[model samples]
Target: MARTSGDDMSAGATTPAARAEALIRRYFEACNAADRAGLIDCFTPDAVHYFPPGLPSAPWRSAEAIADGWVWCVKTLGSRWTIEKVLAGADGHEAVIEWTHWKTSVNEVLRGDEWYIFNDDITRIIEIRAYYASPVNKADRVNSLHGFDYAGRGYHLDPPTPDLD
Candidate 1:
């Protein structure tokens, strides 16, 4: 089963994976806030970060690696991360989380969703994979004051309404 995050602002239990996800969310927020230390807390010291070619390598193979790469991504993107969805589970010792990243750049919005897929059973992230696309024609655009302005940069969460689906 998959689930979307950003809900129960005041009446929900914070599971371990949930805390991890929250930390990940705050990591992005820290990037936006330009708080270097805060962003580094989201990853393991030996964490490995991968992105498409031509993009700089985000390797958190060590604490220093995390610091270096995390800073670079924050600076390079010139943007912050917005998690549109997050689903977490466990395998052996790993907690796996699948999620979507919404970002903006030069007034253009982009959407990227990933299934953190792999042998990440030591923590809570099972796998890591994603897909990104344009938001120019999305149905929500008409009333989206956020506009075509990078996806989720200035966006904040509204309490989750009853899930009708």
Candidate 2:
């Protein structure tokens, strides 16, 4: 079956959370489709986007700038996004999303989270703050970690408890 962004998601975006998620999904889908107009519609006229924690990014000031940013990312830099999780606030005016961005231009995968603050009517995003996560080098930090055993060679988080039925 041929997959499309709009068709991939479920129908009936009735709830505020669902609607917010739908808006975000639509934004990504528009980017995937290279729909410039669609991308601009996802944000408010005076939208703002920021990359926090030392990612040198110019704040996108308006909807046009946001659209241009994404267009440049996808077309010029060859970036793609795969959304992992979306946690909506109780009021449905805010959402935090975990996503993986494949930056083909730099041959890097950025695992990050973004906080989306919706407009008063929940129609579009007013602000987006992104945080990029990076793993610490084993040899860099010398400190006793307070957590589960990390002595044995090759230790990982416990796998899910098996449910043998």
Candidate 3:
């Protein structure tokens, strides 16, 4: 139950930058759909999706593991994760993204960011390091940028895939 949006593309044009943005959009869509295979396809075999310490799962894990982990997170944890923006790096091998997650149960919004490291082929992610701050006070909150109660708690959703289990 996640809703994702991507910036850096909206002109309805197929520029080189737009192609990169497409990858980000598709990754989020795969997560929302809980398509394990599609999610796996976004990463290399040894891909690492890293969360900060003190989270539910490892701060980092293999690509296959992340597939199941994300599904468990979005489905069981009731997080509606969205991609707010995507910025490709000048190096052309890395990027960082801003994400927002609505923690439905806690009724709060979580704001976070993740750094992406692509594989040698530049078609899949090899490493991802995510950072999230504690829930910012709604009193000082800006318009429509609300966050979740458990948002900044560094929750990790890593789990073993069925085949691996």
Candidate of highest TM-score: 2
lDDT of 2 by residue, 1-165 (tens): 112122355546667777778777887677655577998898999999897544345787898988888888877756677565677776779988866665556555555678999987788989998776545223532222345243352322121121235
Candidate 3 lDDT tens digits, 53-165? 66677854777898988788677755566675578765446777777766554555566888887754466777888887553555533213336433354332222122211
**On residues 60-145, what C-alpha lDDT tens digit does candidate 1 reach at each position?**
34445655664664556444455555654533323234333323333334455544432342332232333444344444422233
Which candidate has the highest lDDT of all?
Answer: 2
lDDT (Cα) of model 3: 0.64
Name the TM-score of candidate 2: 0.72
**How accurate locally is residue 67 in candidate 1, as Cα lDDT from 0 to 100?**
57
Residue 53 C-alpha lDDT in model 2: 41
Error of 2 at 114 (Å): 0.4
Displacement of residue 110 (Cα, Å) in model 1 is 3.0
Clashes by residue pair, model 3: 51-59, 108-147, 108-148, 109-147, 109-148, 110-148
